[model samples]
Target: MKRIKWVLGLSLVGVLAVSGTAYALGSGASGMMGQTPQFIRTQNQVGISKMGYGYGMMGNYASSNGAAGYGGNGGGCGGVNNGESYSMMGGPYNAASLGINLTDGQVTTDDQALSLAKAYVQVLNQDLSIDEIHEFNDSYEVELNESKTSNKAFEFLIYKNGGYISSEMGPNAMWNTQYGHMNGRNSGNPGKPTVTAEQASKTAQDYVNQQMGTGYSIEQPEVAPGYYEFMILKDGKDFAELDINGYAGQVWFENWHGPMIKTINNGSTTK
Candidate 1:
């Protein structure tokens, strides 16, 4: 069994022109504050089913990087867990080990578990598109716990796709495993581990202000900084600009897990 580590980083840079007309990027209007887009795909109608175990531990945290101790096993472009091996579905034990504790009809096999997990990934790919789905693969990992007695745990990366995107590991995974437990002892004050909505909003605003400069209304700007990229939105329509970070090099924001707008640098687009 190998321990997998998930690390998220914001290092991608993308530039898009702001076209006033609203164009659905399949993200719907959810990215916008209000005003749902004309195109709507309901979950029920889409027939998208949940994938993997719904347990908070697995769903919330999964490793993405290549590490030893606990990590995911790749197969058919998907992943699964082996004995004492961690995976996205969550399990420190293999099917046979789990079967020991369950009643006659309660337990399932590893193959069955893997099948269910793959099914969920299929539905997610359909809804989010293959590109988005692949993007996520870079962030999550499912593995087993080394301790025979402990259930499977997860390690979540802060970025959306994988640890490759955001440099910070997610708050959820960090608190439970490392920060919460010290030398196998329960720390008295394991602070709550959740990102507040206000905090998300402020992060977005700060990123924009720091790179784009303050006081430049989203609508009109005195001088569009050639260095920093921008995702300008107006009346629910949005477009992005490249070189928001001065365009000396490219930066990938694929790890910006939240819904906030992003800007990446892709070399000099200015004089």
Candidate 2:
């Protein structure tokens, strides 16, 4: 139900790093590029089944129409629809082939989706790790490491047939949700924060002062996924709402939502 209103923009160089070698991903990335269609996993609760390239944990058969709507809007997050790397499998794959009719932006199971998404992240940036993943109406959205600012992080989506839909790199920069603070958002771990509510509040206050120049007030930073979304107030006047990277402390001021809005893939978030 919550929505992020910013774009995480990874530099062009960062995107091209993985985009150039679109096919070389996963376990056999190097050798399997032109040789054969990369096969996905068929696993169950116990673990990955010996049987290779098959259905996922959820019954392999379900009726889901392909409808994609992912990538939330938040300052510093970059997103692409129908991204490059069409399909991980070289060829011969469809919802029917896998015994399911998948709706875009939704996932039946996390492990099944992660098995497929992890490969993509690994190839793009070995240092990066999948921090979260969720099923949307028509696609699976995944976010990577929080080591840097949100704008500098890596995130992407995986299509039904195991194809790389789109990728987001380098979110602009914003404060992380300072959960637990008296004035913080309701949902978030308040303890051991990398950037505490006090820090974020100060960050907001400092930014507002610098931008507006004297006599600016703040309404407390609220947690939104990777960053905090809050408003800067100047005599009840809306100076701006800023989103800042919870860690790196990068920032930007932009919030324009289209017909469909997306947010962090914190289990419940969708596009």
Candidate 3:
């Protein structure tokens, strides 16, 4: 059975003014140093139906077989990109199929994905609510918050065809020092790391420059548990997002969000 991270000292919500987005700082020994915190809540509470991705409320799909649950369908929380099973570390897993049955009218729309995400989080026993959802080519990235507080909690990926959901890899998994899958949902203070935020930023720049070549710029870093995240920009727009390990200095580029088509904020508040 997979465990859930029960966040502590994050109940007190404070307003962080950043480009008009609301972010709150989590207090306690687990808190990271600085104002830019992990708990974020964007005030873009728009309805999904009005967003017009064309994926309206699909249907109430009750999977008695339990294949729609988290890590179900024998994929083990891995993702499918370009029709291939990918490991969390960013590599091909195998040639096996993702075991998704794309039945007619069973496609996972934003609304359906939110339902699946809510159910999955409920099983984990965390008091989280869906904050925003990003619809990519192959999956849906659902960001959760701390109920009424609206403080950012964490994110997970739900496949568009099958109901396979898992914690987002990279920073959300590997560098999350306090809670979540990498920490086994265990509570502990991962003291400050040797690598500074500036160093990690440079590390990201150097890595991207070497791999993706020049003309790529790194945005301001968002401090998470044990990693710093940056939006890699090309022509002053989001080209890709990457994370740097605070301790080991490893870089992981996000390859999951394939050409985001639509987005919905405050999805849980709907229906």
Task: Please tell me which predicted candidate would have the highest TM-score against the true structure.
Answer: 3
RMSD of each: 21.0, 21.5, 18.4
TM-score of each: 0.22, 0.31, 0.51
Off by over 4 Å in 1: 1-169, 176-196, 208-271
Q: List where candidate 2 sits over 4 angstroms from the true fold.
A: 1-107, 146-152, 160-162, 169-242, 245-271
Q: After superposition, how far is residue 137 of candidate 1 from its true place, in Å?
A: 4.8
Model 3 segments beyond 4 Å from truth? Answer: 1-75, 78-108, 145-152, 183-187, 256-263, 267-271
Model 2 error, position 189 (Å): 30
Q: Provide the overall lDDT of each model, using Cα atoms, as 2-decimal numbers.
A: 0.23, 0.38, 0.48
lDDT of 3 by residue, 113-169 (tens): 666666666555667777767676656777666786665556676666455555665
Candidate 2 TM-score, true structure as reference: 0.31
Instruction: Tell me the lDDT of model 2 at 91.
Output: 24
Encode model 2's per-residue lDDT on 209-230: one tens digit a residue: 5444665577877555555555
How far residue 151's Cα lies from its native spot in candidate 2, in Å, is 13
